[model samples]
Target: MKNKFSEESIDFIKDHINDDPAEIMLQSRKFPELPMRDIVVQIASRQKAKNKLPEWFGNYELILPPKQNLEQASSEITAKFKARFVEGDSLVDLTGGTGVDTCYLSRKMGSTVYVEPSEELCAVSKHNFEVLGANIEVQNSTAEEILNHNLVQSDWIFIDPSRRDNAENRVYALEDCVPNVIVLEERLLNSAKNVLIKASPMLDIKKTLQQFSSCYKVQIVAVDNEVRELLLYLRKDNDEEADIEAWNISDKREEELFSFKYSYEESCGFDIEEPQKYLYEPNAALMKAGAYKLIASKFGIQKLHPNTHLYTSDELIESFPGKKLVIKEVLSPAKKEIKKRVKNGTANVIVRNFPMGANEIKKKIGLKDGGEEFMIFCETEAVGLRAIWCERV
Candidate 1:
């Protein structure tokens, strides 16, 4: 990557940094000497980074990748969370696309090597690393090439496989991902004492663990209640059942963490009862980890139904790992009953183990989307389907 854009182009980008990209493109004819298209890309990418990558957005010298790569790159919040696992003297990033993970991990290690097959991405990452003052070596080669040639050895290795196929379709299976960690598991373990793999949140955790011989831990990470990534941690000779951890990074920058042994959830027993005074719904991370029974047992709350994940308690459990709502009333799902109980024609609707979807129920009940109250629809063992009105605690 030679300096394709000149100093004038840089000044132009800085001058119109906050301008609309589409508007900038329409005014391209006025600025004939500047690289308007490239400048517009940088401006647009910077706008997208405003919230996701605040640190990078603050630094004008950093060269961000294209919109697609930026979208695939981990947010700064998640990158910082993943960096806590970094250990030892040296680290190797096997698939360093935009180098966001590598840049954060590099701060914790004595030395770091970033490997990516794309020459363009490698160049851009190398430039960004220099601008950010990160001590990293950029390798323009594939992970397989580096491992096969025995190019480098390190204490820890991290890889986030490409989740897209040649046709640009998204894939969720571990075997379907590029570099196919399933095939390279043995070699990766042989090269490093610990291997960390970032996977799609949609991947089945149990099936993914069965594909690996050394996986010892699995992390389901969510940001602001939305499940984001699934991490598989592998040790050289570990054979224990993988420990499962669910992390919900709240908007307040606090972590709502719950961890359990993979086998414990299957053996746990829970009590089934009707809706009580309060209702609890597990966060996205816990739901993705399949902790339905374990959560009820751990929290000492009764479940509404065997299949329904909603829980209830007579006493308020402030330490529950999810939303806590106080039940105002339990009424039939009939429109007339709901209308009589709920004077306001608006509520936040949530459905669990119910026949109709949330939108369908909302339409049937003639309710709008937003309000101070929540209408939770679920089935209990005693009463088949009931609508529980609640307010956030």
Candidate 2:
């Protein structure tokens, strides 16, 4: 690992901010002493961080990891979201990948410890945290080793296990993840009053709750419309049903929070009816929470089908937490009918629980995939699968 950063190498990286890595490598033939791969990786890492980690990306002195590691790091927005849950004097972050979560969350606590296995990453995190004016203790040790060693009891323990295994295999189960938060959940709770875990967005929430019954709250956080991470907050004595929160962060307005208990969603009843004037689709965070029925019942909207997870209402609900479309026509997915409706030969196609996928339907209907027109293909209790044509609101 390239842990040492020299003045000349830093200058070279700054000079070729926009240069292609291949071209830089070819040009590196002249200067064999410089670390070409490290410099190129820094440039690529900063480029990726531009959109995801704006604060670090804009700073020239901050050292960043490779693109893959940078991708694993949490965005400043998501980190701040996790920070809000932490209220304590001390926090110990085990498996601190890039220290993004540690840096943002440490601001709330007086004493924070960041534990990382990679020596190079620990060095980089120390430098970046220093540059950002955060006073966090960086430790170059594995989580297991630290927990087994002279570990002090902290108020909160945050662990974000590596999603990839030693063989670089992708793992989804909590037990499969590095440090195995599921196996160590009870141990962590013993060390701290609360244990907060940052899990993969793809990790099943229901399965996680089943594994860690002590979870008091499960937060599915999304930025704009994309689901990013699933944060699980666990306490030692949480025996009741956990509260589920779906948070969609937006810059235009305050964070849209849709909270409901899992039992409430399971026990809720929804109405199924024909397409109405307005059709609503739940946001990614809501979908991740599996609060399908609760959303429909709470919004007073009718569901297209039990499995469709799409809602419709006669009156426009301006405060809906997702995409709202005005229905223009509801027709069968017949090729002739679709062709007749899409005279412009271009439309945005969406397929859900339909026999023919979006691409197949697009090809069969002979329409290019670009337009203001929206073609929704979904199943209904009354009709198996039909196409609802609409305009985005």
Candidate 3:
């Protein structure tokens, strides 16, 4: 909320508004209390144009910036929350963002009080609740503010903090954070008997369980084989261990494989190789969770290279968590090798973790936009390979 930004920085942001308008929009909406000029400068400093917002920003069109990672809040997190809380009980959401979590709790909880710091989001949440016809009350204040206001009584208090870049922020163990277990035990825990905490998946699950054993359930969620959300569910005075389990969800297609499509399971096992000319990389959530080898081995797909998570096979596989490819031809780096293939000049290009981006690849390959055919260029642990998509095979 400070005004450390300068006028020069403000002008720079305005100049790029036509191209980087999304950045100005996202930050401005998230921190609405700040002046427009100051917000532009802050966005410039934080992002520095190194990364533009995701093209798939449509998901957040009606929601606010989440303190927790929004992209990670797939069904994995939603399902877990529903399973933990019963209906007709009061729960306090300490850090509500976009109010999506609250939306899921709609059918289960009797009443919910959201504690948020962003004034911008408070107004938005009101609109969302009205639109969805929800009766939950939201307080546009921080957890500390609400606590100071003597508003800490609840059956369950939930927390989903921000820790994408800052590890220290995620270090709130048993005794830290808003109304820690110790504080809860003295006050609300006896009355309400529930406290749910969400932390980053990067945290040590064993350590978290050992320190917070009083709570009965500790849930770790991984969407599409990638760890997205870590949930700790507690009931007052309850003592037990959560049955640790793992699951993968795919909205597109689901399938199982017995062996590697090319390399036998007994032959390659879980080993990875270098990048190949033609490679297939899974979707984002999968990549983030480091389930690269698991997917490859599970689907009987071989990696083009170990360094790259891209997969390759002679036949197409259904039900994998990525695009099915029909690799037509492998192009050599030599312009001459590509010249003959370029004669047709009609196909889409699929680039998987390639040095050159999708546009760069398309430009270099002389392919037109929205073509029926596709070419895959990718690297892996062992080597790089190239191929054309035959079909979803």
Full-model lDDT for every candidate: 0.89, 0.87, 0.54
- Each candidate's TM vs. the true structure? 0.96, 0.94, 0.51
Point out where model 3 deviates above 4 Å. Answer: 1-88, 97-100, 117-132, 147-156, 160-280, 314-316, 342-346, 352-355, 380-393
Ranking by TM-score: 1, 2, 3
Model 2 error, position 17 (Å): 2.2
Candidate 2, TM-score vs. the true structure? Answer: 0.94
Per-residue lDDT of model 2, residues 203-242, tens digit only: 8888888888899999999999899999999899888899
Error of 2 at 393 (Å): 2.0
- The full ranking of all candidates by lDDT, starting with the best, is 1, 2, 3
TM-score, predicted candidate 1 vs. hidden true structure: 0.96
Q: After superposition, how far is residue 335 of candidate 3 from its true place, in Å?
A: 3.5
